[model samples]
Target: MDIADLTPAERRVWEAFPLGEGVDFREGADDDPAAGASWGPERTVRAEVLRALLLGGPVRDDGIAGLKLWGARITGRLDLKYGTVEHSIRLRSCHFEGAPDLYGARIVALVLNDSVLPGLTAGNLRSEGVVRITCCRIRGPVRLAGAKISSGFFANGARLGSPDETPEEPVLQLNHAEVSTDVWAVGLTVHGQVRMNGATVGGQVNIENAVLSAPGGTALHAETLVVGTDLNARGIHARGRVNLSGARIPRHLSLTRSRLSNPDELALRISSCVIGELWLQEAARIEGTVNFRRAQVDLLHVPPEVWPEHVRIDGLSYRVLAPHRSAEQRLPLLERETEGYLPYSYEQLTAAYRTLGDDAAARTVQLAKLRRHRRTLPRYARLWGYVQDAAVGYGFRPMRAGGWLLLLLCTGTLAFALHHPPALKPSEAPGFNPLFYTLDLLLPIIDFGQESAFAPHGWYQWLSYLLIATGWVLATTIAAGITRSLNRQ
Candidate 1:
């Protein structure tokens, strides 16, 4: 295409392409390449020129004078709805007075690097290649709902802010969008919500070092999102909730050193998510509750004490909890989070300890769970449970029963020796030996003719019956504990 063949508007753009080639455009200098470039006297591109460019037709000479519209101001709406654009559009450091309407358009590739745009309305856009918007400043909301990008979406170092600075409004909405590769938004800053709920990513969604602030609402709402690899948001500082509930990540969900603050509600709600590994460690400060109810993960690498005191981990399943720590250290952390007798929590902790081959720790958790459950029983049943716990630790500690038996024997022997009892039948010589008699009364199944031949009177009779009942109860408890221990082994 020769310069003589270009239209008046295209000719202006062609002339301004090489005017300031080597000048830095970031300083907002007046002599910049795009400073003199405009749509035309009418401040609008003709439909014919846009159609020709979108159709991949020749626009400039094939040499060092090739067309490169840098810092040009597209004054009017560039509506390409439902159109098929075959060529790669590279517009750098340009400005758009109005948002481009690309709804349902099929483009090859789009590179708007370092451009200042009002916003983008690209719903259902099908890009065969990458969509690059690196270092751009978007002053309004970018609606990319249901977009399908073959490569990825790169918006690194970009600043996305709402037009009215509304905290509830979404600055970058990617709901249900599907990307073949990663969604790279590293070091990005968003003044409103970055809503990516139900989006699907073939690779990782890297939002490392991003600053997201949407106070009193969700800053990052990616609920039900499906990521093929990791979803890393490390070093993020979010003022509102980071909700990732029901998300499915095959690899890991890393939020290391991130600070999330939503004091009244949940700061991180990861309920029902299926992740390979979850890392909320290394100085991650969350001001609100981090709920993990019903979530399943292979490993959870969080320092339990560092987390907020209001974590909700009921029904959360993980194969390993703090695998880097020993069982003795982890057990206390697990116990500290449990609220009363949460059976599922105890079961999960017990399974984790068992997986580490720490059977003693596992049993200890089970015993604590049982004791807590006993506290919730009815009056009579609770009394019985207390007796079982005190005697044998509910069949988990047999030595406790042995100690009870020793105490009973000492008490019964002292009582019997202090007061001698009369014989049932009068003997020729008075017999008042008490050691063998105490044993006879204490052992329920043994009788040395003291209980049958002679009987105690008044208080002594009541004491003897008490000794008999104590003997039977202690013997039965010891037998039960021994049986349970052997069976468990």
Candidate 2:
């Protein structure tokens, strides 16, 4: 069938994700003459599926784009290698017989927005078809990288782990896409974006490395869609936790309302790639930032609800205790990690402490952070005072805080005494002394008794009790905080 007449917007947008092609060989008699010459491309079920897809026969573009595939059985490999299939090419509700390869094919517009790719194997798959299975499920990982499409790629909330030993990475790939405008793929189903090498997008994109990006709007999207800039999404929805520990996104990189649960050694890495800006803090919920180099990470318009919980880092004991690096002073390597928590935002204090070149400072910061979390993890505590030199380090000091508490106590006590002198008569009481002289200099503030101290009165009886209450509160809080500090040491 002929391609549907394209609209101006569709044509322009399609140009960004130019499709590539490659040769694929099905093990037919032609592909391998050793098979008794009986197996041919025509008889193979794989050949039939390919014919249905490319020839616009059974798997027509219109129906596939809208994801209207109900039930159909094809028992072979569907090879759309190097072929450009516009609209949709659905296999929903249908069963496959063997591992398929819709690889190296450029599939624009998807309709699997409510479909599934169940119970089969498509080892190396690449089809950036949009509107994919937001409601469907996948039992295997389908690689859709090396293939570029315009918009509507989903697979959010889809399960992505294989029950077998040879589980594939992320099933989809958007590594290098010729993106001219925005694309929407938030909350769709995906075992994962298996290959995200060099895929670029001009507009905004949605989809968490682990979950969704927004509660209402799509997970990812560009503020202003670019026409020629190819959005390289290689390693975008990578397996495991996303490692952007020290990554520097130049543009608005959002990861809102998403869940990143990968626990691999190097969860995700976005090191040294000069991006526009990372609008994360709020949208990009990560385990934590991994160690990498970065600059100009934008932090605007992030959805506050999806902020990442800082992970307690274990590597580079110095970085943890010393202090954090600034977005400007931090390394340029793209990285992420779920190692540990950072009490303070590293970017906030990087400039002030950069010149110190003190590794212990990093350790100090880390220990102080552990205290805030109250984490008794022996490792977190051990590094605090020993490897980090907790005593000599500049951390939260309870003693210093206690100083303020003492001042407050003293002021309140003095005020109460002045407000009311003792009830004893001066002639019958002890002789005048330094205590009385002290009252003369300070008895007017807070309406303290203006005419007492030496004469002795009864205001002391009532005000004294009030001041005592204030003193107890201040003293108790300070004492508790100080105790915790001492215990840490």
Candidate 3:
């Protein structure tokens, strides 16, 4: 209303305001040419100008649809703590130079684009409506403890540095808000977002947990803005380096946690706000020096949100080894969540295990899952064949032991021929060398596993040879029977 209605401290601020020569009277809908002409022809609001605006009574309805305080010198404490504005607001070019409290200030549409405000002490403020505060400065710790807004609100490219006199709380606190639409602060240099959380927003939020020092970043308790939907940011610069250490993404996208020292350099943490769908696809390269440690995605079995490919890539890319077999049997694609969710099943685990030469374990994994999810498993479960063959073969390194058996047989036969007596000599036979008959007769004994009976050794060695031959015959018969059964199927 009028300076007469204000408190004593507010009245003193009003009385001193007009006397400050450099009053940069700016209009909400127009740039202040008077603001340009006031500073001794140099076009600037000196400290005196800021002091004047600080003392001016609650900005009255000066006939304009909106008003701009420009660069007003807030020399004294200005309290508009319970004031209310009905129209839109703009603070595009202004600075704060006092302990101004707007604790309950409410406006319809407010914008604080490209502004800077520093105070003598505390920074307790509030705003409502479509607020925009891009490229501004707040040198003192700010507290907008509980505020409400109706539309989109933005404060990008803002900085938060401790003023000449510092406030004990965080540099910026937005504890809660109630916004009807989007709330964004893309490249804000906040001491943190403790102040921002005060408002309960109903739309998407874009505060990237912006800083790295004593506040900000996804560190312990002091995180940036807790967003409503699609929380996103990219090219975010942090102070002592950034950390997304334990921040959980409720939707989809998340940068592999990393250090971001600068927005203009490699240290910037890039974000792709769309965390839904849980999958980013194959050609997606994060294009930074970020290292993804252990992160996973949430996936559903149906309406498949990018499966097989995404799952395998994430699993193989990040070297997701087999987790507990129980987990593997449950959801095969767990390894792929980092990149996206995939329907990893026991079949995939089988493929992985086969590569590791763990056929038995792989078979076991498949068998366990097969009981419940046989339909989901691959058709040709190789484990069936492996169980029939591998277990029986035990330590069967065929080449060495199989070759030794053939050599022993041939050498034994030659010895037997040499040891034969004169009647057994083929040269004395009439018209028959008997070489063919000797082989024909000897082949049966070998088949019967009786080759050791003719062995240069004794009965025990003969029994061993017979046993070896019998095992072979039994194994061959079993293999043939299996082949026949499979063929029938």
**How high a TM-score does candidate 2 get?**
0.42
lDDT of 1 by residue, 255-316 (tens): 88888898867788999999999988884657877788899999988875557757778889
Residue-wise lDDT of candidate 2 within 357-448, one digit each (tens)? 54334344444444434554566665654522333222334344345445544664465444545434555544444333333333323223
Query: How does candidate 2 score on lDDT?
Result: 0.39
Those runs of model 2 whose alpha carbons end farther than 4 Å from true positions after fitting are 1-53, 56-68, 83-91, 106-110, 118-131, 163-168, 188-193, 208-239, 244-251, 255-270, 273-289, 300-489
Candidate 1's C-alpha runs over 4 A off are 1-52, 59-69, 162-164, 323-341, 420-468, 471-489
Worst 10 residues of 1 by lDDT: 18-27
Backbone clashes for every candidate come to 0, 106, 36
Listed in order, each prediction's TM-score against the native is 0.79, 0.42, 0.47
**lDDT (CA) for every model shown?**
0.76, 0.39, 0.42
Best by TM-score: 1
Residue 106, candidate 2: how far off, in angstroms? 5.2
Q: Model 3 Cα displacement at 404 (Å)?
A: 14
